[model samples]
Structure formats: C-alpha cells, structure tokens
Target: MALSSLDEVRERIGKAARLAGRRPDAVTLIAVSKTQPAPRILGLVSAGQRVFGENRVQEAEEKWPAIRERHPDIGLHLVGRLQSNKAEEAVRLFDAIHSVDRESLVTALARAMAKSGRRPDCFLQVNVGDEPQKGGCAVPDLPRLLEQARAADLPVAGLMCLPPADTEPAPFFALLAKLARRHDVAGLSMGMSADYESAVMIGATHVRVGTALFGQRGTEDG
Candidate 1:
C-alpha cells in the first residue's frame, strides 16, 4: 500500500511538473516523516523514495541516525519551526531547513555551522497569510531577514511558506515565488498534499508532502 501510494504521488508530481513546462526532476518531492516510525520511512526508502522531511529535531534524531546508516544517500529536510538552542542539532541532522524565519535563528545556525563544519541549505519561511500564530518572518520583514541571513554567510537556497488554511493558496504561492525572484534565490519550498499542483504551476522547486504519501498521522504503520 505504501509503495503504491508513493508511486501515485510521484506520478502526480511528474504531471504537475510537466504542466508547468518543467522537468519532473526540477521539483523535489520531500516526503514528510514527522511522527512516523523508522520502519515506515524505510518502507518508503525501499520503494525508491530518497528525500524525507521531519518536523521535530528530537524525533528525527531518534529515528534518522539508524535509517541513514542503512541508506546514506537519502536527504532529510527540516520542515518545522526551529529553536535557536537546537540549531546545532538541526544542522547536524538535516540537509536542508525549510523554516528559517528570523535573525536569531540565522545567527545560531551560522555559529553552529562554523563549529560543526556542516552547512545545511536554508529557506526563509514567509508568513504570506499574515497569521499571528505561524512561524515565519512577516511579509513586510522579509527583505531585512534575507539580508541578515546573507550577512551570516548561511546558504540561503530559497523561500518557503504555508498558505492559510481554508482559503485560496495561489496568491500566497505566487507571492513567495516573486520574493524568491527578487532575492535571486532559486528554490521555492511550497506546497503539500492539498495544493502541490497549484504550487508547482506557480514555480515551486520543492514540495513538502506527507499525508499524500504516508497516509494520515497514526492511521497506518507502513
């Protein structure tokens, strides 16, 4: 069942990419594995899924080290809020971070990278929806944050966003893409199971998908 679901999601990604006149390889599918067990993730790995996203550093630390030992080529992305104190652990565990939204986190990540000699690609999360509760740099503050990230010498790969729920997401996705263009950043990590196709049409380079590939949380064991 997991293999078939993965295959179906890959097919959807390919179709979405083609519709955008882009190569399927241009958009990476990051299978989010937060709250999932190692065996479940390995099941996806067995089915040829190479990239995964996790929400929490502690959960990833508990599961990924063993998984990486067996499949060293897999890419792990941190797709959730990151605390300054965990910057070092996050840098050590993730190949890319998709929720970098503030100057302090950037500074911490920079110091961690310097000490650990490991630099992970980073995306500035923008609160395109203007929600007070979301974990992203306010849209108005994006430019300043970007400048701070560059000054810290972090590898700023792109911008990421989570559009407001129960509303149209295209505008938000377009906004993020526009910001990335203005900043000359190439990657746009937007989209998920519900609206990835729309995101791809608007030029998303990386899509964080979980339920579409892994089923609802706690519903299946893989």
Candidate 2:
C-alpha cells in the first residue's frame, strides 16, 4: 500500500516523537496551509486531519471563512505575526493565535474576545534569535508579558518562538520548554520543517510544519 499524504505526515510525526520518547499523539501537527488553494485544504480535511495553521490575516479572511462554513470542525490557528488592527479578525477566525508578542497585541486580543463572548487560545511569541527584524518578545521581557496576560484574564496557553537561521535550535527550544514549565504554560509551539525533531526532544507540544509536509508553501517563500 502506498503512503497517503496524511500517512506520510503521521510517519514523520511518529518518527520525531519516537526519537524524543513521546507518543505520536503528544504532538499536535499544525498543517500549514498558507497560499494553498481551498480545495487542497478540503482534501486534507477529508483525510481526517483536523488542525491547520495560516500565516496571513488577510489570506485567512479570504480563504478560511468559506471553507469554515463547509467544514466547521476544522480548527484554525494563526501562525504568523499579527498586527493590532488585525487582532479582532484573528480572534474571530482562529482557534488559536501562535504569534502574539507585544502588550498592545495582547490588549487588542483580550478586548476583542471579551466582546465576542469567546476567547481564542494564544501564545506569546518569543524572539529567541533576538533578531530585531523578527516578531517575538525578548526572553527578558517574557515574564512581565506573561504576567500581564494572566492579569487580564487572557488564557495564554503557552509560548512560541522562531529560531534564528544558521544555528542549531536545541538551546532555544530547551529554554522555551523551561519557561513553559516555570509558568505552567500549556504548550511550546516551536519548530518547523527543519528543526522540529530537536523541538520535540526539547518538549514541544505543537510543531508547525509546512514545506516538508506540504511541499513548500507559496512560490519564492522561504
């Protein structure tokens, strides 16, 4: 029998889990669906994979809503940097937001969820690479930010980070796991196609994978 797409993903996920002494179900495989047409997503849903991640607010606004109507069971997660202006829409659409860093974004998401009568699960995006160009809370500032989120009754489920390019990711993932444990955070949503196994070893509960599973997302995108 041939390996279907979901089977391939399961195999990859299982391998990564086994290497880390974890069960396959311990990791939530966030199938990144950025720029793929809706039909492709629908096909994946038909195969019984339930969770999906998207990178852009506008793109989700355009694509997820219609698909949402048809497959209401599909869970949506915002896996990209989010602006304050887009926070409300993000809370409306996504089951979780994986990239929240600033106090302003937290305020926006909290307010939006307050009015909508629903709270979207969220994670603080940490800039583990300390790259000024990327979007994440600096490690030093994370405690204060996590405090603020809790003070505001925002159910911050965990922390998320992007490792800097050209480096091994173990240290960053280890630190993230430690932080998650210290705060009793529920998740560590790090790792992607290349470094996910390291993330699993370091206690990642959710891994956002795109290219290695979906065969590269969007033309000319890294």
Candidate 3:
C-alpha cells in the first residue's frame, strides 16, 4: 500500500513539474513521518523513499537514530517549530531545518552549528498569511531575520510557509516564491498533501506530504 502510494505521489510531482516546465527531480518530496513508526519508515526506505520530515525534535531523536544507522544515506528534515534550547539536538539530528523563524533560534542554531561543526541547510519560514498563531516570522519582519541569519553565518537555503487553511494556497505560494527571489534565496518549501500540485506549479522546490503517502495519521503506527 505504501509503495503504490509513493509511486502515485511521485507521478503527481512529475506531472506538476512538467506542467511548470521544470524537471521532476527539481522538486523533492518530503515524506512527513511525525507520528509514523520506524518500521513503516523503513518500508518507505526499502521502496526508495529517501527524504523524511519530522515535526518534533524529541520524537525524531527517539525514532531516527537506529533507522539512520541502517541507512545513512537518508536525509532527515525538521519540519516543525524548533525551540531555542533544542537547537543543539536539532542541529545534531536534522539534515535540514525548515522552521528557522526567529532571531533567537538563529543565534542558538549558529552556536550549535559552530560547536558541532555541522551546518544543516536552513529555511526562513514566513507567516505569509499573517496568522496570529503560526510559527513563521511575520512578513514585515523577514528582512531583519534574514539579515540576522546571514550575519550568523547560517546557511539560509530558502523560504518556507504554510498558507491559511481552507483558503486558496496559490497566492501564498507565489508570495513565498517572490520573497525567496527578493532575498536571493533558492529553495521554496511550500505545499502539502492537498495542494502540492498547485505549489509545484507556482515554484515550490520542496513539498511535504504525509497522508497521501502513508495514509491518514493515527491509522498506521508507521
């Protein structure tokens, strides 16, 4: 079931990429495995799924070590809000940090990277929708945050965003792409299970999909 789902999602990504005159390989699909068990992740690994996203640092720390030991080639992304205190652990575990949205986090991550001598690609998440409860930095504050990240010598890969739910996502995706271009960044981490195709059409380099690939959450442990 997972294999077929993976194949279908890949095919959809390819089609979306082609429609946008972009290569399918240009868009990476991150299988979000927040509540997923290690065995199910291994199943996807066996099926050639290499990139995975986890929402929490502690959950990832608990689940990924052994899986990574067996498959060192797999890339892990931290796709949730990262606390300043967890900076060192997040740096040690994730290959990419997609929620670098604050100045303090930038400072902590920079220090952690310096101490660990391992710098993961970082994305500055923007609250494109201006929501009061989201994890991204506000749009007006992005420039300052970007500067801070650069000054700290952090590898700011690109921009990430989650549009307001139930509304059209294209406008938000376009905004993020524009922000990336304005900031001279390269990667755009937008889109998820329901609207990844729209995201790819607009200019998303990375799409995080879980339910589509692994089934609905809580139904399967993996």
On lDDT, the leading prediction is 3
TM for every model, in the order presented, reads 0.96, 0.94, 0.96
Which residue pairs does candidate 1 place in steric collision? none
lDDT of 3: 0.93
The Cα local distance difference test for each model comes to 0.91, 0.85, 0.93
Ranking by TM-score: 3, 1, 2
Ranking by lDDT: 3, 1, 2
**lDDT of the structure predicted as candidate 1:** 0.91
- 18: Cα error in model 2, Å: 2.9
Clashes of each: 0, 0, 1
Worst 10 residues of 2 by lDDT: 213-222
Candidate closest to the true structure, highest TM-score: 3
lDDT of 3 by residue, 96-172 (tens): 99999999999999999999999999999999999998889999999999999999999999999999988998999
Q: Which has the better lDDT: candidate 1, or candidate 2?
A: 1
Residue pairs in collision within model 3: 37-222
